[model samples]
Target: MELFEMCPVCQRVCDVQTRRMGTFLSVEQLCPHCQFSRLWNSQPIVRSTPAGNLQLSTSVYVNGESFFKLEKVLKAINLQLFEYDTFLRHAKMFIEPAIVSNFKTSQEMMLRRLSEEDKIIPGGDLWADSPGHSERSGSHTTMDLKINNVVDIPLFKSDEVGGSCQMEKEGLERGLALLQEHGCLDDLMALIFDENFVDPAPFKEEILKVTITEDLCAQDERPVKEEVIESFVTQVKTEAF
Candidate 1:
């Protein structure tokens, strides 16, 4: 619904709309005064005012950057009753499921599109442990040599991927398991990995088709084969095969 009123943030009359789907509520209000746009990702709660008018208000927990704005507003207004840190953490609990659901949907769609293409190759990456992390994280993504469109598969911290040093093989094995779990066919033209990367023995036939690119420098001290693939995959992400 569109509303004609002064914006609370910029104090200008503008058109505002509120939409709700399932438990998710979105409020978009643009300020003509400062040309600033405000979006609120919240969950709705219905209550009756003293005047008997039904009013909708979001709880302290909300998603994304707008939630921080709400905190700023509260501080500006000298409201100290709310627990900012607790609510901040709770908001993530509310938002992570939706993020996961959306990611799965996108992955399925990408896989479907890739299945239709005959020339696309499947490759993976074995990243060394990242900073501020205790374990190494290795993962794989789909690469389309035809259009060079790389569809990245989001890897969560909890995802079964292992460290590149010791867990490289385990990481690749987990990646293949996920592919089979998704019902992906063995239509991949080639599997690419680092030269000394451990073999995924479970899928030996599938692993036999693995391709290793020569390192430009010494070829021996070269980075893992999947390193190049991972870099390119990170550079370009598109659904088009």
Candidate 2:
């Protein structure tokens, strides 16, 4: 504000017009004394997008931070910032699409590796948005137990599947479909499930249930569900050879 008070060319006090968008600032000075005019930008523009605007969107999405939370902080300090609609537009138009594209590229590489295997014993689990039956959404993750790499993750909303309890089954179905779509289902030898998983009746022949006893938990020192699945995989591999 102080720097813009006096025009540099004319060396006289002048009125400056300022525009702010998120972290980007633009200042235009038009001095009446010498008719000097100048426009300044705080940051560079990338394509049609302001660099600061894109950066803010990228940082918020990648760090798992919500725009509303940041908005509250900015409001408290009376700082100039973009609106929620603009953030949402940036996320939908840029952030989420790029994330999905990158994920697909990585997922295809993993699927190729899994396809080359003679047998794939993938571990599957469902994570609810909350630790309860009435959670709004859930995601099922399928990991290749042999290499300990994630193969697929399918997210489901409760409303889409009737209820939160139904999310697990829906997610598992979607995960299996993903594997099938990628031609990796043929090599699937067995599917391991966590303690919470039940009703393997749909795919009982390929299901291997492993429980993480207290001793097993103490020995593995990993997440209880993952340790149980990996222990099952280890035992299967040992017996096969």
Candidate 3:
């Protein structure tokens, strides 16, 4: 069993790593800082150090009496450190909640600040998906506006919320309620959305329910219209016996 050692010239001399495969053994002398490394391969060479007698590389010079190992170690290490960098950049290394929260708070603050300065118009998209191949088991996403900075809302699995598509509508309502709470709904200029989203009568009704201002931008259905964002609020369930 050969033990790995440090570059011997590191800030804190420590053990370098070795990866072994059967009879073939590989060792590295890696620097803690500059990340320079010298790879060596050889049959386990036993030598004496101040620490104790240990197995190391036969190629490395120790005393005047140097004996060669029957086995030879291949000396090759790629100059580019892509392997090390890719491993370090892996997604699993991230703390998801902290990252999400940090960005979420920053974006919300930015939107609020912008709204205060100008009548910032925002839009929203409602997303729905069923992972389990059942409507009841599907999930719904809240309104996400590509315009103003997006607010991160936690996903609600349908199973957890009575397995209903209605939750998606609720998510839309939740976003509208948020804007209302911020006291910026009255400044809403225009909203654009797909025509099939709902009936025009109910669509107008839903808008009036949360109407903060009298002027609801209305126009004749154009044969061709530029893309507009849909900003709608769904009804919230009231608890009653």
Candidate 4:
């Protein structure tokens, strides 16, 4: 009998012999580090869609200074604006809250609504169960909301601007090399960003005004979606590998 099987959590060869009381199968799998349960289970059904046929549409705005250069750079890198958007959404998840707070405002609001008994107005009952509905008859509490203040943070800082400049230069150099090797530069560029460059200054200002309100009833720590993390990890791994 095989003594071990690959541990999915740690990606390591682990003991397969079961020692626990409820063990029935000859094979017992166990992770040494995290003690995650090793179970002899059926392989999950994997469903995949055709990559090329899956169409995705997205748009991003670039500053005038880097507009043309960015287009050239993206073509060289074998990536589109949508791919960058995917990467950025992933990157933002891990960004330090201190950095986030610097450009964001944390707001706490107290929501108090009249109870069914306190419905002195005509539609008090409607609103009573609306915003601050409490199961225990009468309750009032404050909810905290955090919002990213885009205006507080400049898109490009003088000191950190070099990093962005270097990344674009390197991305273009690499992308161009790949395109030249693959002979897809002209074709890919023609397909991507074919539209005229629209100014983003006005829209960016509007986005900065958006705010996030926290649900008071929800637990303090919200669950992070696994799909988001997995997609982020896959993107990083693809880039690194």
- Report, for all candidates in order, the number of backbone clashes: 2, 0, 4, 6
What would the per-residue lDDT of candidate 4 be over residues 1-241, giving only the tens digit for each residue?
Answer: 3436667787776766642111112245777876766455222211332122111111222111433465567679865432444334423543334346643442111111111122111100111222332221211221111221111111222233243233333333433343334333334443234423456789999999999777896757665799789999999999998
Residues 41-136 of candidate 1 have per-residue lDDT tens digits of: 653343311111111012433222454676677678865323455444444544456556877787778767766654444456655446444554
User: Quick one: best TM-score, which candidate?
Assistant: 2
Cα shift from native, residue 196, model 1 (Å) = 14
TM-score against truth, every candidate? 0.38, 0.62, 0.36, 0.15
lDDT, model 1, position 180: 49
User: Candidate 3: lDDT of 8?
Assistant: 46
lDDT of 4 at 159: 33
Candidate number of the best lDDT: 2
Write model 3 residue lDDT over 68-167, tens digit each, in one string: 2212222133111112232223222332444567777885785476457545444555455643335443323333344545653545656666546566
Which order, best to worst by lDDT?
A: 2, 1, 3, 4
Displacement of residue 189 (Cα, Å) in model 3 is 14
- Candidate 3 residue pairs in clash (backbone atoms < 3 Å): 41-73, 192-228, 192-229, 192-230
lDDT of 4 at 187: 41
Better of 1 and 3 by TM-score: 1
How many clashes would you count in candidate 1? 2
Q: Where does model 1 exceed 4 Å of error?
A: 1-82, 85-89, 126-164, 180-241
TM-score of 4: 0.15
